[model samples]
Target: MAVLCLMLLLLAGDLAAFMQPPVFHPNPPTEYRTPNCAQFRLPGCPRDLNPICGSDMATYANECTLCLKIWEDGHDIKIIRNEPC
Candidate 1:
């Protein structure tokens, strides 16, 4: 009886530990950096709908966001086109 009770207590403890929420690890499989893509600029920019194609071949929301990316990430992105992709 005492042995069974001990086993049950250990099992309960194990079950409780297993039921815990998984811990979040940063960039589990691969390292990643969040892009500084923004819809609006801090100093305020024109609400132009003109999309600028980045040198990375990605179309930005506007020139403001593109400039932010360059300034923040130091990306070698340049204006490819003044239109959306």
Candidate 2:
């Protein structure tokens, strides 16, 4: 009986951990997009989006927005977040 109770507890813990949601999401954040999805950052521009990166600043930002919505709700994205703002 004691062993069975311990097994049950362990199973519960595993389930709880498994129940947690993933950090990344299918969609991007609306407010966290890049500047030039296809272009790179210039001298003064400090572009946001990078064509090679995940998504364009605007597109990816929109998609990544879901991440914030699901995880960091009501959170503001940093301009120079990953790379140049």
Q: How well does candidate 2 match the true structure in TM-score terms?
A: 0.32
Residue-level lDDT of model 1, residues 1-85, one tens digit each, is: 9999999999999999999999964433242234444656554666767686676768887788777767778776766566654
Model 1 residue 54 CA deviation (Å) reads 0.7
The residue pairs that clash in candidate 1, if any, are: none
lDDT of 2 at 20: 98
Choose the strongest candidate by TM-score.
1
In model 2, the runs with Cα more than 4 Å from the true position are 24-28, 31-52, 55-85
lDDT of each: 0.68, 0.42
**Candidate 1 TM-score to native:** 0.43
Worst 10 residues of 1 by lDDT: 27-36
For candidate 2, lDDT tens digit of each residue in 11-70?
A: 999999999998764445465343332242222233344322233232233323323332
Model 2 whole-model lDDT (C-alpha atoms): 0.42
